[model samples]
Target: MSASSQSEPRLLFISGSSREKSFNKKLAKLGENIADANGIKGTFADLGDYPMPIYNGDIEVNDGPPDNARKLKALMEVHTGIFIASPEYNASFSPLLKNAIDWVSHIKDGGLQVYRTRVFALGAASPGGMGGLRGLAQLRLVLENGLNALVLPDQFVVPKAMEAFDDNGHLKNKENQETFKAVIQKLARAAHVLHG
Candidate 1:
């Protein structure tokens, strides 16, 4: 890469649910820890911190995006890669996550740089057998098709999430831990190649 394009890749972790003890949140935290252990810089962001009204075109025209939307968009812009730990709502991703994406997409930019330029990885934690994989499929579709973002083909999923982590908040199963690390490392490598 040229000197101007050779920048350190940073990963941002976002949890879809805002509950204090959310399983998805724990998964995101574990992702950060794994990324750190592997020498990748990652930041964990709580979506609750960036609150915005439900998306509506009328609201957008009347007041523009809420301040929180702009802040979240800016945050996404800085990171070269993003990992979203989404909770399954029915068969889809959580409303909170969908809303955040909707608001960010309406930022009035000529190009959807935040969504288009970043490499995204999707993961989920659930007590159910599928580990929210169904929801993750939907999320990947949105990121890749709706927003024209480049997303990794592999994803980490934690099933029986309540029992997936140990006391120290690391994955309890060794295989699961390795799987998670592989996915995260792949994202880091891809981000560096694309953005560095």
Candidate 2:
């Protein structure tokens, strides 16, 4: 898919893990490709590039938000749609992702509430049979209840994600690819309906 030339991107995708070969990141790449193919501008938000210390009230009070947190929060506000590809940690999503959410939520009152009206979608990729499906539920609760956001009911969970993608990170199975494309479409349409 070609690059989106829009001055401001309408949608953003992020993988919740920071691992080098994170399966969730591979899944998020599929969402990006699908969005661009469908003429939707998708921005891939890398948590690794936006590193900050774990949230501590003392630190936040002393130093204010870290530079990376501020940068990430800024990026988040520009998008009307959000799609998250998360990896399961224990029975929930990653602490890295949770912290990022906390940081961004703090910035909501600083400007237009980022999570209030935007549309959100979720997915997960795992090597296990459940494919991180359990974590997606918790993630959904945090987005909808904790942040007061709107989330789509349908979600994708790619089991055996270790074997799901090729070397170039594209889903090798034709059906899986199509489903991922559908997820992107749903997010884009929801964003248009809510934020257009």
Candidate 3:
């Protein structure tokens, strides 16, 4: 790749759901489109592609980071921002998402402090009325402590997510579409400021 391409900020999109037809995945894609439209390069990181057992310090020390964990950390090092589309499991962030974060955080001298100073944004979708709002709230707290980055206050939550998408997999809800745009704009702006 050219030097310019190499220097462009890469946005990593992490989908919390592993289901084939996950609404959070759809929302993540929407966020990616918004980022691309705003001249930000976005790439999706599939959790299923990296299946590590639930995080345990003993297991990590015994086997070191799984290949997937190493690959994810490498991507995080190059990316300018992380856009997480989480699904509410029960009433909080999904275990899969938490596990991914746990693995990524464990790298860098085997501590989560490596994520400090990174930029991140959170979004969630669900069939429930709250639209995974509770989950996003908790996620913000974790990201704040772990990533040490500014997360946009305006978050996107798609209620009744199954009905929020069209046959082509594009988000159909107007309010959510606007919220997604705003969130991406804020992330891009923050990333630019931090990058400079």
Candidate 4:
């Protein structure tokens, strides 16, 4: 690929939660807007749009991964980088997100091709004091060790996420906003080097 094409990162932004007004969903949207403003190609996605059954070995053995899983995998394969706004669930990432990952990983099509080939960045928003940082830590482990994916070290968290954003959906905290932007930029840089 040409240098310019390689340098331009195509990012997939996903919110792990499926609630209509989920904090993580809004956070994902903010990330998408920031990426778009910076001239990066970013696609914001909702887990609700690609629903899959809770992963089951029996189902996999009998039927195979659900069609939604295949569709999501296809969408992910085209991107050079991914950004996930995970929701905290009992100090870990949500089951909805976990199920999706499990289903996608089960696909034998390219054998972890999507995870191995792309760079990932993680962020979270929670009403608690930790700002969903705990969930992100676990998510990082899954991406790095389980999937063997390249993930950016820096992560963004929004505490009291219900009030973290402004009316326009932008982060109200300037410092936090900058940190999120930096994380996204770092992902872009890493993806370019790896996929270029």
Candidate 5:
């Protein structure tokens, strides 16, 4: 990769839901911690911190994206990989998550760099048996085809997530925890290679 095209060695974690006690949010943080343990620098992205109105092309033509979109784009520019923990809503990812992507997708002049330059890993945590895997399926398709992102093949799912974590947000089951950590480690390794 050319020097200018290579981003810094960092990973980004984003939770599809913005709820304070959301299991998906906790999963994203856990991914970050696991990435750190695996010797990779990481950052957790909060959608709450980057609020914007529902997407509208008229608004974009009139005023461009909200300030938060620019801020999010800047963050994406620094990280070479992304981890997304999506919440299930109506058999798909939450509207909040989709809206965020829609707004960011409107960016031009290298705005789509995040999708093409970085590798993305999709995961989910849900109280249901399906573990939000159904929702993740839609997300992967949208990110890969709609946005043209390079999503990782391996995905992590936390089923019955409400009962899966402890007070510290760590998964109680040893096997599940190990699986989650393994996913993070793989993402770090892939990011390292792609950034070269």
Candidate 6:
């Protein structure tokens, strides 16, 4: 098939980091590079820009979703898949990402379940030995319940993430890069099959 005929699927990459120099952000950027190399269009969405107070149904009932929530919902609608690269805070996902998700879920004018039926892939990075695998596991369960998303079974865990990238923020670990690429490729392929 021609290159145009083989158009790649588009993914919305949600980076769960609020720090300017976050290792998880670097890992998500590396995943974007891998996605580009695999002929997938990846758009990175940083959680830092989308700030919201912790979810409170009573508060939401009084005040509506913020503008950032609307923007994220729009992006989610346009993309075929979502790839989340999260960081472990304590033993769970960063509060920033969790808040963004909460805000996105409150957009009632748009479909109640904006993420439902979408394909999702999960990954995490950390300085710890297990990376953020435990956090990603917990996140998977939450995402499944919230979105009813088609969660991919494969996941990428980048432990000692600071050491895996170079000064320019490119992933230097060949094995991890390969594994990351494979997971994203599988997500794109599955999205195509399920949504085509």
Q: By the TM-score metric, which is better: model 1 or model 3? A: 1
Residue pairs that clash (backbone atoms under 3 angstroms), model 3 = none
What tens-digit string does per-residue lDDT give for candidate 3 at 55-93?
988988988877888877776666667788999887789
TM-score of 4: 0.94
On TM-score, the leading prediction is 1
Which digits, one per residue and each the tens of the lDDT, describe model 5 over residues 132-160? 99999999999999989999999999999
How much is 72 displaced in model 2, in angstroms? 1.0
C-alpha lDDT of all candidate models, in order: 0.88, 0.83, 0.78, 0.88, 0.86, 0.79
TM-score, every prediction: 0.95, 0.92, 0.89, 0.94, 0.94, 0.90
Could you tell me which 10 consecutive residues in candidate 3 have the lowest summed lDDT?
A: 1-10
lDDT by residue (tens digit), candidate 1, 1-196: 2221436778889999999999999999899998888888888989999999999999999999889988888777777889999999898999999999999888887227778788899999999989999999899998888999999999989989989889898988999899989999999888888876
Candidate 5, residue 38: lDDT:
76
Q: Candidate 3: which stretches are off by over 4 Å?
A: 1-7, 109-114
Checking candidate 5 for backbone clashes, the offending pairs are none
Clashing residue pairs found in predicted model 4 = none
RMSD of each: 2.3, 3.5, 2.6, 2.3, 2.2, 3.6
- Pairs in steric clash, model 1: none
Which residue runs does candidate 2 get wrong by more than 4 Å? 1-9
Instruction: Encode model 2's per-residue lDDT on 50-103: one tens digit a residue.
Output: 998899988888888788887876777677788999999998999999998897
Clashes of 3: 0
Q: State residue 170's C-alpha deviation in candidate 2, in Å.
A: 1.6
| Model 2 residue 53 lDDT score | 89
Collision count of model 5: 0
Clashes of each: 0, 0, 0, 0, 0, 0
Task: Locate the minimum summed-lDDT window of 10 residues in model 5.
Answer: 1-10
